[model samples]
Target: MKNKGSRRRPNKAAAPRKGEAASDGAGGDRLSKLPDDILLNILERVDTLDALRTCILSKRMLKLPTMLSRFDIDVGNLARHHDAASYGYTLNHVIQYNNAVAGVAEKILSARNLEIPIRKLRLRFYVGRDGCLSISKAFACTMATQRVDNAEFVLLTEKSCLKCTHDNLLYYAQQFNNCLGDYPAAFAGLTHLWLRNMRFGELDIPNVLSTCKRLVSLRLSNCDAGVRSVLHIEHAQLVELCIEEGKFEAVQLNGLPKLQHVNFVGWCCPDPLTFRSVPQLRKLRLEQIGISSTKNLQLSQFLANVPWISDLHLDFRSEKIWVLPESPKLLAPVLGKLQIVNLDNLPEGCDMAWTMFILEAAPSLRELCITVWDDWCKIVTDKEFRRKNGYCEKANVEWQPSDFDLKHKNLVKLTIHGFQPDVIFVRYVRRILEVAVNMGDISLHDRKVCERCMDLDPEIKVCPSRYPRTTEEKDMLKVEITKELGMASHAVIHFRS
Candidate 1:
């Protein structure tokens, strides 16, 4: 018997166990009690090494690393602990980081339970002698022993593209070729690969595509065979391809039966791309800064082979317009299937009527997005730099509306970024209303803010922005638009600040 006012200290043997304590809502390791599937899902989002370190803290989780089916071990993750104050890590720091990544990857791969299949494996490592060899060997062994479904490798050089010389790029490319020779099994098993700051031989890239038989995606950044070298790609399984800042004069898609997506950026050649056989291509994106010598892209002739494209994105990079406006008669055949179009970074003061060519051609177009702004910070403002780089001066694109009657019944939504309360914008909106007869919604948004743009020299003449601010101004503008158009527009106009 126990007194009601006194503490009952008699039933020590009836105390709850740790598991019972957790169930009773007392303090306990609730995370460890979670199911393995839930725990694995939580760990999969983090770096593989960090996940393994977390697992080592609990006895129940100590064996969980071996059961993991995915790994993303990147040397870039180690930069969080580094104290460097530069744009990139130092050479010694990068070397040490690569070694750490290699050690962690090897440990996990070597200790993994072979019964559990690996679904994905991604590794980003520096291209050093010892580190590359160790990493290549570990990945090769994993590919040979495990049932890996997808593998990706992002090889990095010690120096960035801006810091690397021609000799450095050549050296990196040779090292990569050697690595490919040494570890053919790993390359063969890869489904995705990214290489940067490398200048390969004339036939090196073609040979690489031939070796990577199962590759589905390939990205080359700041890498080229040589200046003005023609790159001909013909792959059986490739579905997506991206080339950024490469110096290839022409990239001929000789044959890619399964390819569906292509993205090309920072191209300077007159005619940078040619399509021969890409029957399944559906999405294409091109971004470039227009220069004096760069010829305007003619989509009518350029996309004749791939007419089934449904999604198209063209970024002018706030320079001279690089796309030539063609008649709808010539463009309709190539653009018949186009449904979505994003014309990004058109110069601020250009005549927007030229854009109507797209609306006239793509009869099935349902949504159109246009961004008009001159981002001075991204544009080279220095006269000498612009001259040296062959950048063209900012000027209005000369174009007039064709005499053909325009009527698009499919367009339902129109979005304009960097909308201003000026004649150019108002006129553009009126033209859109006249052409897009079935348009239901028109959204006008203010320009995107850029903190870097504030630091530019005051002398640089940025386009004066006159965005509607007060409610009265907005209502007045709406009234003025309706009054000038002389008809009731069925589209709901929204002015977004």
Candidate 2:
């Protein structure tokens, strides 16, 4: 054996050394050979802190920030170590983190060819007693010159301006002044802006708007200050706008020739006299808001005047109707061209009347939902009044099934709620279900027919003598019993009657 192979137990160390060399030939060597541009692209995809860590690898990676087209600085990450109760004292960690970001940003700013003009910038900071102003001032200064094509500013805090002093306003003004003072003329080409949980007064709104002449979209959420004041948006290039839960008077579109979508919340109501100015407006949503309750103020009337809007959503939750006679007739012709209508939380009395009116008016109305109370007396009384005047009698009218055609042939879904599942209701459900079974092409249907009739009469349960059933009848001896009741269902599948 020694003569053939010279293997006196071939050295194990040599084999292990060969395997180590093979492993080194793959990943480690390949990664090291990748071009700097490719490595910078990889680092750019990670968060800022992770991006910074790439610098630790080698001096060649230090210039990675110049390749970043986007920058998102989250200040909340800095303040995580401070307990709320101990927040009155200065947090050293917050200061350190701020300093670190400032240094990185400075590097980004100073890079000549490496500082690619940012296409987007997002800053999230909590406005608070300790460190918000300085951070905002710093961020604003950077933004004022960054030539960002899009920017988002989010300031969150539980502190209310209503509780703060004049000094607080002065401090805010100083920060705002810093941000707005030399706002680079470069931002005039920016296209989008989003602000959340940040308050701005009348002066601030105009000042910010002036910076973005080419802005196509703007969104504000949960910000308050001069909320009741109307806005005059004068951008010719704007197309979409959304404002929610902020106090603002009326919204006036100044000169947005390309504008199409508008969404609003809080207390702004469109002025009926000035709505048609935006000729291209097509879609609008109004939610969780108040409209004038004066007898002369009518939503339908106001909406009718605007011919450009094709889609509308109105939510009047817990709101009292200001206009009297709650006629669907007034709303129908106006909404004839509408593709969708959502009426939520209308009062029981108003709901019934509105339903009838809508069914009559909008022959083109596509969907309807109505919720009524569980009171039997109210239903009976209302039905009696409607029937005496030649409205469909409660018993004669066929309940609309999910497939049933409505005044509008296109209606697809109808949901009703808050009805007492009593004897009368069960019979109503039975009638509706019977009608539904006869309809063709059933799809996505839910018919919750009552399983039992409950006696909702309060006085009937108090005395045994007042019980309607006799002992013999209860035992099948047959005693006579009687009660009268009343009516309605969805807007779908056409019925011959």
Candidate 3:
């Protein structure tokens, strides 16, 4: 018999029998019991480093990494301190992190099973010479040995655009150009490439495009040849192109047979883009802060060459309206196939009836989405800053509908963000109801909240917001809207707070 104070010794029989697994609290190793395909699918969705760490938990999972078809290796995912100094690491730390990334990529790519083809592979690392070379060689070896379907490389500079000088950008571009020369095979197999904060030479961009034979998508942020320089892109297999904060005066799509989607942002040129020989183009998005000097765009002339666009998005950045409301007859040929339109960031306290041009132009339009908000945080509030930067003051856009009797049967849904209970908003909705007779749904949403704007000084003048709240308020608003329109509308009205 045991003493009253004595505790029982651990029982050997209660433990797992020899050659059997121990219980994992919930049960015996449930995740390891799952089939290989299901486990691999779960692992593929996470970062490659995390997947590798999970594999270390069990012997069964150790071999799964080698069988994975998709690998996403991003050095940014590495655990680091949250302090301000660690936001962008020092040179030593950056090199260390990149080396670790290169080592892991080499290990995995070298040990991959040759029987399985790589469906997708992505590597994002800092632009370090030795680490880049090692990673490029590993990628080249895998591309030569295995059947790689999609491969992407996202190269980041040591410094961000704000911290980089003109000389720094040129140096970064030269470094990347040297890397391309050293690893032609790796680049030739690349399908997607995203480059940032580099100002290449006049011929450098075209050369890079020509070398990447299989590139399907390319994004250049804060990259350009020079101010007011024209960029002519000609690629055979490219499908998607995005340019952000570039200094190019105009981007000419000279020859891209398979291109379909384009997005241009923060362009200052009068006519920023032109399309040629892009038969498959279907979607376009343009966002800019219009100044007093910027020329207003006319869609009829702007999209004359590319008449196959089905989705168009225009963002005015809440400064000035830069898109002219044109006659529907002039816009019909270009907007014939348009099915969706998103007019984002229109200034508040302005006439919105000018937007009816889209309804009259696109006979095939099925959805129209508009967001009206004047975010104080993004707009310049200081008088001196506004004058120095050439920012135009807020003003109403002048336009009158060419035909008020226009009828649209295809528009089914209308969505308005920043909906206010005011006469202007009510009148705009009534006009849409008059035009779109067969509309089925109208969704009105409150303005998007901006944290920085909330912290701003209370002295800045802005329109008072009166968005409806509570079920009773919404019901009353619906009744008032219907009463103002003086019609028994058939559309379902929803108020999303």
- Greater-lDDT candidate between 2 and 3: 3
Best by lDDT: 3
Candidate 2 residue 56 Cα shift, in angstroms, is: 6.4
Clashes of 3: 0
List per-candidate RMSD values in Å: 4.0, 13.0, 3.3
Question: What is the per-residue lDDT of model 3 for residues 1-497, given as tens digits with 9 covering 90 to 100?
Answer: 76999888887668777877766766578888899999999999999988998999999899999999999998777625223455667767777777888888889988989899899999998776576676777888888888999999998888988898999888778878888889889899999999998889899999999999999999999999987888999999999999999999889999999999999998868898999999999999999998888899999999999988999999988889999999888999999999999999999888898888888888999999999999889987889988987888778777778776888999989999999989888878777887887888899999988888878778897777789878788877777777655545623678877
lDDT of 2: 0.49
**Which ten residues in a row are the worst by lDDT in model 1?**
482-491
lDDT of 1 by residue, 25-131 (tens): 45667777899999999888888878987898799999899989989998877666565553467667766887888788888998999999999999998876666
> In lDDT terms, how accurate is model 1?
0.87
Cα lDDT, model 3, residue 296: 93
Could you tell me which 10 consecutive residues in candidate 2 have the lowest summed lDDT? 477-486
Displacement of the residue 343 alpha carbon in candidate 1, Å = 0.9
Whose TM-score is greatest here?
3
Which model, 2 or 3, shows the larger TM-score? 3
- Please report, in order, the local distance difference test score of every candidate based on alpha carbons: 0.87, 0.49, 0.88
